[model samples]
Target: MAVVGSGVAGLVTALDLLDRRPELTVALIDKGVSGESGSTPLAQGGLAAAVGPDDSPAMHAADTARAGDGHTDPRAVAVMAAETPARVADLRRRGAVFDTQDDGSLALAREGGQQVGRSVRAADATGAEMFRALRDAAIEKARNGSLVRLQGMVVDLPLATTPEQPVIGAWLLCDEIAGGMATPSQDAGLVLLRAQAVMLATGGCGGLYAGTTNRDEATGDALALAGRAGAALQDLEFVQFHPTGLKSADGRFQRFLLTEALRGAGAHLLDADGNRFMLDRHPDAELAPRHVVAKAILDQPGGAWLDARMIPDHQLAEEFPTVLTGARTFGFDLATEPVPVEPCEHYMIGGVATDLHGRTSVPGLYAAGEAASSGVHGANRMAGNSLAQSCVFAHRAALDMAARLDGAHADTDPEPPTFGRDTPVTADGSERTDLRTAMSAGGGAIRDADGLQKLGQVIDDLRAAAYRAWGGPKPPMVRDALEVDSMLVSARAIVDSALHRTESRGAHFRTDYPDHDPVWAGRRQRVQLTG
Candidate 1:
């Protein structure tokens, strides 16, 4: 009855639930406007689907598993790959117009870790186009009164009054930030929204890092909320870094991502001396898996850059207009100049543990998108798979939730919700900054035992300080306060999982144990926080 966040998963889940059971009361809750928020709009790499004549779901699955490093879930990968084409078609039906070839076929582009071109794109603004269609559809559904939109966040999962269910609703914290009115008191923003079920489509935690491509809103609230509610968070160590983030000289512009499709369009990776170097690192070179290419760039002594000047100006204007305009804003021209590039935190592969259908360990609880660790991408995610994974799993979760409610006494008109009171822990700004710095230095693209140990200690100290502030009279629960809490808990879980996994595998690499261990294959580290 309640879905959190408003990305592809959140929107589609709400839509599909209405499709299956027309009588259900669905509340689509989000911290921003239902359609314009979350990381889905930031997805520029496009969605991976088997649309090429030579491409197939089997090949897509193979590439997904290979990018996953060593421990991706086989069943989840198969489901995502098989269902992706249908999801793409659904997007098209919803009004997404992708670029097409001369024969009017979908324009499939190749990215890293792919054997062939299979990712369908809309120039370089694929995510924007997808979000536009999804947003319009969601808004139309809202107009028809199929679902009501709540501009707020769910702080905790509360239990039902009945003994039969463990968690039957959510605790919301609304504020003026989303144009919602909170209580007169600063520390009084809790409202109990009891429902038939609760879904978390809140996206990943990339905003926790100092150098990340995620928006400021992406603070891993789902991971923090789930861990506190006794749900297991799995594979917390495998955070993926994108290989090409714009880093211009003189620091004039802030960092932004250069989509993998740019490289697929015949761009080159150049060393400091303007010589191609990716070929020496891997057979696929610029098209190699993200982890290999990211690591190679970090290993460069002077630094690396992306040379897109070789790409035709007309093609660049048509296919990479967004990228070109963005680059020009930072004093670089993609069609005529080379731009400095480096790896930055792009995606989080680990998240709240969930089954293939988005059901978490807790009953009546589910998750999708980057928030759910479905194990489809074991160690790392290939470019564009996040969009496909989100769409596929959200549809499945919606179908399952609808089946559970069909003639099964689901509360269509739940009792009017009430308010609850509590002292929210104050966020320590200085400690928050230290946490990000420590995470970036110790648990970032490369890791070692010493660094992870230090990072763990930093998290422990910050967490203790954060809780100590909750003992006295409570202050207002500001946005930064919520984000800092999320950052601390998430940072602790990630570092703890990274420390537990000794061997280097996938996106998680340890300098101490640089080789893959046969004993660790098909294995993963899961964390369930008690505090």
Candidate 2:
């Protein structure tokens, strides 16, 4: 089996497959180095699970449903919440250590939308700890010949013998940095490997927006690849914007994020005059659902700030070393200053649609992590729920893939297609920066119909220019094809979905339609490419 992406979801999926079916050969592919593409490594908040004695799966499920604004599938939410405890236990068995209280109970912190303190963390760097453990486990297994780590970018899913047949494998482009140089020799060109099943855990589409807490590789590659292969997609418009990204001096840009965990730990959101703002906006104040808080911040005049001064310095240093260090590096003291903040693209609430078992519409294909819309985070996502969702669904996908392999089936792998010999080279350093700038400015937190329409046109023009520059009639090499195809497809999807959803709901707010409509409630709009 083949798994794309090296995040927590991909690594766990691979490990689960190895444990479940030791005989199956698995290949794991990633665009960057292993453990780089996923937001898992950058996550500050911990996994949201009912690990406390006072917590229950039902309570977790209810919080999830309520946060999603009634669009969440009850079955999916229940499945995730019910399986969360076991998943946490599995992580512990694999050497993941969650922070514990003085009384010997698991330390649970709260985030937006939770009734009880249930977020399990590790020194405020929860993602780093999870990534390290998962990566070490996967690497050990890979070294022992249980799995293969393909360091390359996946271009497309190669078709099987028939259109209705299961997917056999993917076409890959091998590109890795060696000796501080990016070598693009033909020896590192296209490669094809047959697999029993394919799982896409390729993170999220956060990079499609201007400002995001996601890493550079979160470019919607999985969604675009699946869409090109005709997979079903849903809720493309529901992109969650976190309200606390550090703002730049210009007031038009944002830097890295200050996690929602700070608020859960007693920090407050204040206005420029040092007045607490959330209390006036919502009864729950800082503990309100993510979408509500984000919208409130956006609506508030002169923006907002996060007051972290209330926490003791020694305790802050102990619990949030990452944030504290980052603040120091930027020449600021978190204890004295109210951090300037604004909403930024924080999460994708929708992606390639999948079932409870991680089965997509396409045969022999499954997905997990932020790339798959399993209906867990419907219209809005709750803080810390993403990590739990990834872990639970990764195991589910692995089990389903193992089931398919155990059943009697004929070999369906087909000869892979070849790209043109004279494909255009991918962007150099300067060109890549330009592309990012264009995407960010044209598509950001605030959007108008005109800007979105113009952005769509710009993407189309860019694609045409890229095709013309390539000089050959056939598609370019896997790397170039993947980059161009992903950008074009993602841009089109976001623009089309934003245009279709005429009401302000969740993360998708239209200034043209400033008020939410009852008719638009509880409904998710699907997007597909049409002639």
Residues 1-531 of candidate 1: C-alpha lDDT, one tens digit per residue = 888888888988988888888777777787765445688887887899987899899999999999888788999999999999999999999899999989899988899999999888999888888888887877777766677677666766765555444466787776544232211222336666767778898898877777788876788899988887778899999999999999868643255888899889899999988899998989988999999999999999999999998888898999888889998998888877788998888888999999988998888888999999999999989888989999999999999999886433344333433321245544447766787678888999999999999889888887777666644222235556667777887888898889888898989989999989998899878888885
* Stretches > 4 Å off in candidate 2: 176-187, 251-254, 407-442, 472-475, 478-481
TM-scores for all candidates: the values are 0.92, 0.92
Q: For candidate 2, lDDT tens digit of each residue in 377-455?
A: 9788887799999999999988887777863443665566555546465454333345556666655555667777887
Against the true structure, what is every candidate's RMSD? 3.6, 3.2
Query: What TM-score would candidate 1 get against the native?
Result: 0.92
lDDT of 1: 0.82
What is the model-wide C-alpha lDDT for candidate 2? 0.79
In candidate 2, list every pair of residues with a backbone clash. Answer: 210-440
Span of ten consecutive residues with least summed lDDT in model 2: 177-186
